[model samples]
Target: MWPEGIGTGAGSLPGADPREAAALVTGETPEFPALPELPHRSVGADMIGRTAGLLVDLAVEVVPTGWRVTPRTGRDLRRARDLMSADLDAFDDACDRTRPGWVKIAVAGPWTLAASVELASGHRVLTDHGAVREFAASLAEGLREHVAEVAERTGARVVVQLDEPGLPAVIAGSLPTASGYGTVRAVRAPDAQDTLRELIAGIDAPVVVHCCADVPPIRLLAGAGAAAVGIDATRPAFTGATARVEALDAIGETWDSGVPLLLGLLPGTAPRREPAIADLARTGYDLADRLGFDRRRLARLAVPTPACGLAGATPDWARRALALSRELGKAFADPDEVPAGGAGPA
Candidate 1:
């Protein structure tokens, strides 16, 4: 699974430079570096496009609205493959010096992919149960090959992070149809969990299920065999009196089970006034106290990160955020070592 006191990104950085992104992430979060996803690079580099390119037999092409299934491999699919290959090369080159023991790579989870991609009929793939199953199987096969290649290239154990930012919308039936006139039918929780569990079981590596939504399905993901669950602890839906009791209970139970949490506490974008590492880490510290866990338990159960992806951040803020995240990781492991007032502005 995950190492104690580790920090990493939620994927997607600000720039289009793969080499730079790889180097920055490896340098900043060496203990648990993640493969940088640069959506700014264009269609192929985006979360959906990148993951779509990994499909075994399925092919997707970009339409005016978005990506849709195609009968055959198209130029869009080819370009996506090219971008992903170049990124892998960049990651390999960047890690040549550090050779981190563990590396993370993210892909769109099955549910999100289904909800986002459209079939030939202009309906979401999730609308067809058979198609959904087929896509999941293809994705699983693709991921296995992708993992093997990455492990071979970097000589490190690969950690698969399944990004499910769309799962909440899918479960709530809030995702608009292609026509935008109606919503897709809500998916049953049990069905979603089963699909996710099968996908996780298919992959060989330890899986981390990430969902930055206001109300991430923590209980379902945890039960589906995620080695770790990623969420934004600072999200309004997860904190204070406004937070849902079910969400709070799920988080507390997740920790009580000894499953590490990739807790997002720092701002992903630039703040008006730069805060100290101590200031940024307070959310996590306070979360531990409120949950009735000893502060030291954070060292074992929490890994600090930005609230979400840094794609919208300025280049400088992105780098600073990663550095601060690393610092917070160290602080989690040794709170006494942090300065009294706070470390200066990152």
Candidate 2:
């Protein structure tokens, strides 16, 4: 794992400065740099413009269906790609002129992309193994170039986060079983693993796989050579007395493979203050102790992020949350100065 601080979503930048938003997302102080304020904009546009401006070096913006290409919609997917690419380039420039760090460019993983993208026949590409493989290769190539471009602009490492929210569902065959969806086809575990391995290998920087759902293919992700595995920390998979053992098993598996875990501790939508900070640290330490991992290694592996992105939050809340994440990160890194048992910063 990269052993960095918290990361928030590109919070809504509508009429808000991009630099400030970028700072918020990357845990930089508010006074770092201001960005262009884009008000009342679409989420996709807002994410692209604001994230690029935040000097994140790398980020991903999910375009809603209106922007996505579908046979039924007859929308030009190329146009969407062009717009996203341009925004990334602009963001890359902003990073060069301002903050310098690894730039992260993200995209939906191939399986998720196939699950969502519809062909002219109204069939989901995910059902077709051949088609899915092709899509995965295409995405890998595209991201490879995108990473290269971001690197050229920022002269920093380019990490690619593969967002695969549907991975668990697919693995469980839930996607195929859902009504209105075609026959449930299982993805061979090895094939799925190989696809991700190839994608990660093609990238120039360390790779992280993020899955917010329960019982994600953590072992598979590690085998694929991912440097870190990000999962919801507040809502871990284990419950009851079995929770501790299960948690340890999970953490041990990842750590044994030398893959650090990014513990999602922050409640992205909640108020941020001392209480929140205390809660986050306690949770981090508790998990570490249960997992039998070194507190220091846990500190380095534990990136206190929101359970997910904060696009749903208010601007003020998002800002405060970002600040709290940074503060808690400092405390986690140096527990002696910031006691985990304390009631947080007053």
Candidate 3:
């Protein structure tokens, strides 16, 4: 379902020009490319805004509280759709000259989307069972059409990366109500997994679920039928010397089960100087060693990505970070590329 290189975890350069961002994505990550998400542009291009564009017959408008469902279309909703459309146009043109082999597109997953958007009554959509099912169905339908359109224009196999950054909060019931007096009920693991399964069903594209949270449900995501689970590998859960047994167990189990892990190894910020590719790639190498997988297995099972979105990075840093990541991908392919002694040779 993926190739061996670094791909953007969906969001790109710090500007409003979707074309420049999209074009940079195409130019930088040749191993695999993704549709650049330009959330820095404004409200509409953010994760929630982009996913809102895909809601069928449902409209979400920005309010003082956040995204709220509306009975009729509104300016906020229109802006979201317009920015999304412009992104598509920019992406189409970016890929026009030389069609890509594969392109990953990101949208908020069912649980995250439900948790983020509010209903007409000012409560989260996830609070209502019927609304949850409805929104998932609408998202599934809308995604199918969106993927088809992207495939038509870019001539690349479209891979969907469902960003579930809010899933942990949803499962923990940490999200406060609009009034901030109480919290929403925590969703059971089974219910959350099943809901996600329904959202991805029949979508007809390989799917990757990205959760950069401290406690992303690795096994649950696999059970939900995600082809790959993107995680923040730099987090203590995965990297600390005494990283919790649960994290180790999950990593071992997921890989042993033949599921790929989209490892987030790059920092999404500007370092004083550009780091060496091997220096940047050491985490993946060490991870493979820790998990007892052969060095070569890293290339086969791991897809490198930024620790999170690059929206906060300067434009120069964004491009450089991606370029360095592509090199990390190459290093994954050639074990000797990292040198035997230490993080790449001096």
Candidate 4:
């Protein structure tokens, strides 16, 4: 749905000011501004904690071993809901002031949430297929309500992004057990795809699956009917011959299927130094060229994003990063703004 090169954050800004974060996003990305995620506020405000509020008839409590399922609603779950309500209020205020067109909201995908949360037995919910299914159903219903509320409050179209940072680990069987002495069994690709597919189908709005890992199962996600697959443009290099070859193939397949790629071209964390806009834009241009697509096609098929979340960044850098990300969007929209060679002028 991006007309010009639209800018968006990966998720998670640096501070607790949802209003300020929302204001920055609305100011920079006029076309598509996302609800800013602020994990630095700690406890229930983190991605996992905030999304826990969406589960139907489910409750979670923070433990020494992270978040564990509870038999009934507890303070932890209440805290999560309270923080989420505050964020929404802030977002509503910001939207009323800025009047954005379309706003994006992020939640942990089924796979990621299941991987992060623990059952009453102290094992990950992903370890139990039945639990996973129930969690997915709950999440689907919760997100529907959340999205409808957001749209009604802001008077803007709502788009949902499912952050699946743990999907790669789930597929690879890399996550440790609650004891940390063993790894959980890896999920097969087909099963993973099926779970995600069903989950995406339940969401009422457009869904973008975000996974910042080096190998994010791009083809599987795109095939699962994700409108967009978000990945880190820098961490996942396209220069190598092994994984890069497979990644390139996946990118081509996803694009060929009419799916947009949310490219993380800008730094999310503080960079060693200020980055040149052309340098970042060139990453997308080069990627397009590698796939034998014209640079101009990137405007239609890509959404510029930060390399990852900005939770670890300085407040100043976070704002600067968002601004830079917007500049990259403009460059993608018009290559002449910053030539593909990555240098502005002779």
* lDDT leader: 1
Global Cα RMSD, each model:
1.8, 5.7, 2.0, 2.2
User: Candidate 4 — worst ten consecutive residues by lDDT sum?
Assistant: 337-346
Alpha-carbon error at 84 in model 2, in Å?
Answer: 2.0
lDDT of 1 by residue, 1-346 (tens): 5577778887789989899999999999998889999998878888999999999999999998789999999999999999999999999998888989999999999999999899999999989999999999999999999999999999899999999999999999998887889999999999999999999998999999999988899999998988889998778877767777788889899998877788887777898878887776666777887789887878788888887899999999899888888888888888777666565335
Model 4 residue pairs with clashes: none
For all predicted structures, in order, the TM-scores are: 0.96, 0.79, 0.95, 0.95
lDDT of 2 by residue, 246-293 (tens): 556877788777777756665656554435566567777777677677
- Give Cα-based local distance difference scores for all models: 0.89, 0.58, 0.83, 0.86
lDDT value for candidate 2? 0.58
TM-score, candidate 3, is 0.95
Model 4 scores a C-alpha lDDT of 0.86
- Which run of 10 residues does model 3 get worst, by summed lDDT? 337-346
Give lDDT tens digits, candidate 3, residues 107-189.
99999999999998988998999999999998999999999999998889999999999999999989998779999999999
Superior candidate under TM-score, 1 versus 3: 1
Residue pairs of candidate 1 with colliding backbone atoms? none
Candidate 4 lDDT, 57-132, residue by residue in tens: 8999999978999999999899889888888888888888878788899999999999999999999999999999
**Which scores greater on lDDT, model 1 or model 2?**
1
Candidate 4 wrong stretches, greater than 4 Å: 239-243, 339-346
Clashes of 3: 0
